[model samples]
Target: MTEQHGSDTGPRYAARRRRGGIVSFVVGLVATLAFFAFFPGMPHVIDWGAVLASLAVGALARAGCRAWMAKEAEKEGKRIGHF
Candidate 1:
């Protein structure tokens, strides 16, 4: 059996892996806003600071998850295909 190394992965692959956080951040922001928008008085009822904080938390979680997954894949000698 053969094992693949991280050196074989290109910058594009690294970028692809990192993109998860950015996507999650955008999705989180949109989702948060959407949730607030459902209310009749969104602007007055929603706390903007909390919404921003939630987006930040979501992005950080995504980054952590991506890193863990990459480490596990590397340990298993598995290739993470392009998204």
Candidate 2:
């Protein structure tokens, strides 16, 4: 008797989820920035320095997430295949 093996979905699912999340994050970020740019003096206030800081933080966050996922893939014995 042969044992039935399940199809692999981990890589595909993870990639899809990551792509969707990044796209949504980027879109939301752009929208928020545009809103602030257009209505700079609308209310409480808007600080350009804060905007730059947020962008820097986002960059660092993205890098960290990528590094973590890469390590996970390595542990799973998956090759870091080229896009």
Candidate 3:
């Protein structure tokens, strides 16, 4: 059996990318909530727009991580194929 040395696995990259997105989304949501909670009578009303914005932030984080990782892999001469 032959194994590639100093190479990255596609699944690992995918997982990392996904994690980045999830973490970003959670953080954004928490921050949004905290902002609203800072004032009295804020928690009584839920802001749907803030929730949607968090989703957007999450998507952007995932995309940014994917692009950055791919670029780094290319720079290192490692070809990370689609998984």
Best by lDDT: 1
What root-mean-square deviation over C-alphas does model 2 reach? 6.9
For candidate 3, lDDT tens digit of each residue in 1-83? Answer: 54443635556656776676667667766766566557676665548876676566656665666677778877887657662
The full ranking of all candidates by TM-score, starting with the best, is 3, 1, 2
* Residue 6 Cα positional deviation in candidate 1, in Å, after optimal superposition: 8.3
Scored by lDDT, model 1 comes in at: 0.67
> Judged by TM-score, which candidate is best?
3
Q: How close is candidate 3 to the true structure, as a TM-score?
A: 0.60
lDDT for model 3 comes to 0.65
lDDT of 2 at 50: 49
All predictions: root-mean-square deviation over Cα? 5.6, 6.9, 3.7
Model 2 lDDT, full chain set? 0.57
Q: Compose the digit string of candidate 1's lDDT tens values, residues 1-83.
A: 64546664556556766776677767776776667767575564557685876677677767776777688767867677643
| Per-model TM-score versus the true fold | 0.53, 0.51, 0.60
Worst 10 residues of 2 by lDDT: 1-10
Q: Rank the candidates by lDDT, best first.
A: 1, 3, 2
Q: What would the per-residue lDDT of candidate 2 be over residues 1-83, giving only the tens digit for each residue? A: 53322232356745754774476556555655666667656553448864775565555555566666666666766555432
